[model samples]
Target: MFSSGHLSFKGRGEKWNSTDDGESIATEISSVTKLEVLELCGNSLGVDASLPIAEAMKKHPELKKALWSDLFTSRLNTEIPLILKTLCNSMIVSGTRLTVLDLSDNAIGPQAIGALEEFLSGPTCFALKELYLNNCGLGSAGINVAECLIKCHEAALRHNTIFDLQVFVAGRNRLENRGAKALAKAFKTLGTLVEVKMYQNGVKQEGISALAEAFEDCPNLKVLDLNDNTFGRRGAMQMARVVGKLTKLQVLNFGDCLCRRKGSESIVMNLAMNCSAIQELRLNGNEIDVETAQKIVQMCKSLPKITILDLQQNCYGRNWSILVSHFQKPFVDFGAESDDDGSRDGDTSEEESDKSDED
Candidate 1:
């Protein structure tokens, strides 16, 4: 019975869905003003729909955040700039005070990615905390989003504009060695980022290792998502090795990664033993079995760090509790009894959280 105020669209009995569902959310938001957060995912609403929202937003002038993440959307074969025309024209993208934008799994052209350079040059993007362009077409083109970020960071520095951020999850957006280095270079300079997700990009071991080095120097980033980026066992071990050096990481998702179970376990245990800073661990879809779970348990112990654990769609069962009991981290989305057998518990099924919180 809600339109634009606060709406949660979901199927019955399906718990632990990610709030990234942007589809089928039709709110009578025309008259509403002073919106705090707007999360509509996969709704197939182009930039035109944003005109009304933008105009209304101009009046409300209090809209803090808006998430249009479409995790399941197919890549747009066009270039990145064309896709972003709507954002540049009428939308919350260039607005001030707006934070957190997840445009994951879209095909964004490189030129389009670069076009944002002009946008970021403006004062609008100063307060942005998270800007997710994962799985976007930026990777498809010879261009690299990591490079764009680097350019943006330099622009911010040159302009002397205040920029602070916590999360910058924009992976699965094809980043090769040069591009990854650009990101790492930017990180080395800025100490604001806390969590960075870069899984499924074409980052090689060398590139990840570079990022690890940058992270070690940066002093801020905590959580990292580098799963499914073609990081073989060696690459996973190497990337985890990078994180092991970082003591602030709280969440790490290595599910269905290129690395095998052994490699992943090594990374997890290493985080638990050495880092002791990680809290949330997501290793779902990696095909880890009871044996692997046993190893994970022996390594993971009571610490103030670890919390929410996701082992769903993998191997662990209800008995898996024994391993996670030492730690206070609550387990959800275990997928032990899930009919889908592919879903996880407590995990954001979609990109943006359907859950609207002040944060």
Candidate 2:
């Protein structure tokens, strides 16, 4: 395969858990000096076989992208933080152009998140972008992780320069109020973050307040996801106050948030009143009262920038089509998922996994 030179797995993903014989494949991969992208996610390989293969790719200056999903590889027996430290100090430091890091479903806890917090929180990570930390089980109940981010702020902000950011962190417990509060502090410090997801964490009123305040500063924050959380009336009200301030907010998903229609009304009206930046809005799984649905439909009509509206699972389902018809321009139905428009990237994938939490 190395001699053939048709080395392209560009769009292939692991729907089938095919383990290409590690020895020969690793040898071939190690020799390729011009590889632009490499993804070794979700295979049942041991760290004993994977570490050397990853280390071998370090020599290639042209290597720019990598996806190392599934944390069980390195965390089989070792503590997660130590493994992250090792990976960051070794592979991350050498790849000057490396941009994407997908560490989803590895179950890295608050300790690992805290350890990597310095690596990503401040200015030390300027050239890097696109971080996926989904299902890592971040800390939700304490302030240590949050305090650690504040402690590392100066250089973490100065060096962790990820201008083109697209972060995904979900399906974890550590994203509770304290953990989320810590993350919000770091978000405020960042310069050019664009997208974020912390769905299903226990991010209550205080965390949303912090996020709302931080949201005012992030000039590039366009898409945001806070689905399945505890951000309720006061939190939604806080989000309402500043939701319009984000001139680039295109997509928003607050699905299944136990919030009453008032919360949705507060935010949706706030956005409709001022933010021409919003293109897609999701109120799915909320117990939105019919009055709020009517308000949404009325407001969305004037929103020239809006292209997609999702109100599925809201108490007002049949009326969903009523509001949709008033939209003169093309708009999505409740479950329609257009191109990377909203947070989920597609309706089916998000619906199936919408119940899952994030941070």
Candidate 3:
């Protein structure tokens, strides 16, 4: 039942495949006098169902959040683009200024990027603050997202408004160097991003360097999680060079990034010198040596607001006591130490694992 301008069919496990199902949902949607939030996750929606729902969406210009993740479970890839196009176009026509648009876990491939281009580049998304596309399998087509965002920014400028996108999450998308660099360009243009999470995307040094440069433009950035990426020495150094600029950064997750001892030292030293608001820091499974890990803990002590320091699955040897002595207030997570060779079987964090299972 819809209540308080909010309607949710989340995790209903119903498959709305026919026009009759679409009309039934549309009738309920149109009946909401002031629909502001709609949650349609955990249910399968086909093109037939989407058309009527989109038409119903046009009646609600007050819509703010569209939580529509995991909506296509067994549908054909070809049908997804049309469904997205119809729904997003209706919102655009309704003159809704969406703040949060979560389409995560949908496996919307490169082909569907076109469907979202018009909606994102138009005035409808001028107020979009949070965009979630995790596990969408964007691949090389992520460039289209960047391009659409750039166009959105341009449209905002033309309309004398601001496209202040704050949070962007696109993990597990396999967006390699090409996709990352493209989004970096868009991020540089927006310059209002607060948090950027792109973990497990196979981004290497080249992509990371571009993103680091883009981060220089985002002075208000607070959280940056690039876990499970390949950020060897050069990438870490590049990121270190820009950490001084992001003085407002609070949560930094570089876990499983393979930022070796020297690279880790560089990043930690820079954070100590520049970022003072850092609260949570995760450097697990980075091949950090005992000496460098000690140095990291010693430096982190200077960060007044430091809370969570995760140094798990590294080569921390027998000096656990020395590291634990540094932080008595903040909880330090020092998972099982790695072998002398700094080898671990699985690098997925408990948090990431939980999220994966949930999605």
Pick the TM-score winner.
3
lDDT of 3 by residue, 189-267 (tens): 9999999999999888789899999999999999999999887777888898898678999999999887777778889
**Tens digits of lDDT, candidate 1, 1-359:** 24555432222222212222211222334345445566555544343343344444444435556565652243333433543554544443435465666666555556556545555434455566887776665653423544445555666677787566667777666676666777877677666778888777667656766776777764566777776654445556666777777777777777665444666677776677677777787776764556665666556654456666666666455545553453333443455444223213444321122112101
TM-score of each: 0.63, 0.75, 0.92
Q: Which of 2 and 3 is ahead in TM-score?
A: 3
Model 3: CA > 4 A from native: 318-330, 338-359
lDDT of each: 0.57, 0.61, 0.87
Q: Give every collision pair in model 3.
A: none
Evaluate model 1: give its lDDT: 0.57
Give residue 176's error in model 2 in angstroms: 0.6
lDDT of 1 at 77: 38
Predicted structure 3: lDDT: 0.87
Tell me the spans in candidate 1 whose CA falls farther than 4 Å from its real position: 1-30, 46-62, 71-83, 90-95, 140-144, 158-161, 176-178, 232-237, 256-269, 282-297, 302-359
Instruction: Name the regions of candidate 2 deviating beyond 4 angstroms.
Output: 1-23, 71-86, 92-95, 111-124, 140-153, 156-168, 171-173, 316-359
Task: Using lDDT, give the best candidate's number.
Answer: 3
**lDDT for predicted candidate 2 compared with the true structure:** 0.61
Per-residue lDDT tens digits for candidate 2, residues 66-137, read 566673543443455654554455455564355666777766675566556655544334445666767767
